[model samples]
Target chain A: MRSSVIIFPGSNCDRDMDVALKKFGFKNQMVWHNDQSIPKSDLIVLPGGFSYGDYLRCGSIASKSKIIKSVIDFANSGGLVLGICNGFQILTETGLLNGILQQNKFLNFICSNVYVKVKDKQNKYFKDLKKDLLELHIAHNEGNYFCSDDELKSLEDNSQIAVTYCGVDGTENEKTNPNGAIKNIAGIFNKNKNILGMMPHPERMIDKYLSGEDGSLFFKNILDNFK
Target chain B: MKIKVIVTLKNGVLDPQGKAIQQTLNGMNFGNVEDVRQGKYFEIEVKEKDEKKAKSLVDDMCKKLLANLVIEDYKIV
Candidate 1:
């Protein structure tokens, strides 16, 4: 399979995503934010980092970058696009996903391993995954997810909610809500399920010795589904 | 003409920075402080001499870039 990881000015995780994608048998290319066109690929990633110094708002500036137009077009065409961490923030800013990732409710940057329950497996991102919950790494200050009540209702009704924060036993509650995301939403899919935006960094957790293997499961599942 | 604008989080939206400032003020014994909210202020000097046109341009800027309509409200002052 082929993949492309878009690199914004300050994207710190693009290399890690490239490594992870290649490790999972994907031929991954790094695409710069200023480029007008992206190489044809099966998947495109907006990796984690403080793009544009998190200016104006996290991911707000990067969302308007030159390359984003192509990214949005790709998504509109039903191509698979994944946004991780700062990438997730950019997706929301671009209106590709619902809601805004506000600052954490506690007014602090949180960096830790979090358990995320896969809310639905109907999408290509998580379909056929063996586990209902995966432990992933979250590092951000603005990870609090907020949306209008009506939007939330629609998302729930459509099963657009892809993953939510939860405990290891798959229990979801306040204790597991690290950043005060609404309803513990850790990630979500667009109505078509071709686009996914999430706060966790699966690229950061692809190695068992360095971190954990849940990310490996995530990458492997996507490649298998594509094949 | 110079256009001035203020952008603030909409009512009912959580403002953690504002909350922290409120707590800090309370700790400093400013007990009368009911609540606090943070916002952004921008002043743009447009070459257009017409006040109405300048204000309209700034309004457009706010709607498109300065403020995210989903979570923030912008007012041309």
Candidate 2:
């Protein structure tokens, strides 16, 4: 499989995502944010980092970058696009995903390992995965997720919610809510499930020695599902 | 013509920064502060001679790029 990782200015995690994708047997290419076209690939990633210095709201400016038009077109045609951390913020800003990732409710940046419960396995991103709960790394100040009540209802009704923050034992509640995301939503899928936007950084957790191996499972699952 | 605009979080949206500022003021003995909400202001200079046209262009800017309609409201002044 092949993948492309879009690199925006200040995208600190672009190389990490490229590494993770390659480690999972994907031939990966790095695409610059200024490029108007992407090489044909099975997956495209918007990696984590403070794009455009998080100016005019996190991911807001980068969402309007030249490359974003192509990205939006790719997603609208059912292409698989994954937005992690700042990438998730960009996806919401682009109107490809529901809701906005507001600043942390407590007004602080949070960097820690978090347990995320896979809410649905019907999508290619998490389908047929063995683990129900994955340990992932989350680092961000604007990770709190908020949406209109009506949109939330539609998401729940359609099972568009992909993963949610949860306890290690898979229990979800206020204590498990790290950044005050609504309903503990750590990630979500578009109505078609081809696009996923989430706050956690699976690329940071791909190695057991450095962190943990659950992220390995995440990457492998997508590759397997594609095949 | 210069167009002025303010973007604010809609009612019921959480404003953590505003809350923090309010708390700090209260701690400084400004107990009369009932509530506080943070917002952004922008001034755009448009070349149009007509005030209505300048304001209209700014209104489009607010809707398209200056504010996210989902979480913020923008007013042109």
> How much DockQ does model 2 earn?
0.90
Q: What digit string (tens of lDDT, one per residue) describes model 1 on residues A85-198? A: 999999999999999999998988999999999999998999899999999999999999999999999999999999999999998999999999999999999999999999
Correct interface contacts retained, every candidate? 0.85, 0.85
Provide the global lDDT of candidate 1 against the true structure. 0.95
Q: Clashes in model 1: which pairs?
A: none
Q: Which residue pairs does candidate 2 place in steric collision?
A: none
Model 1 ranges off by over 4 Å: none
Displacement of the residue A88 alpha carbon in candidate 1, Å: 0.4
DockQ of each: 0.89, 0.90
All candidates' TM-scores? 0.99, 0.99
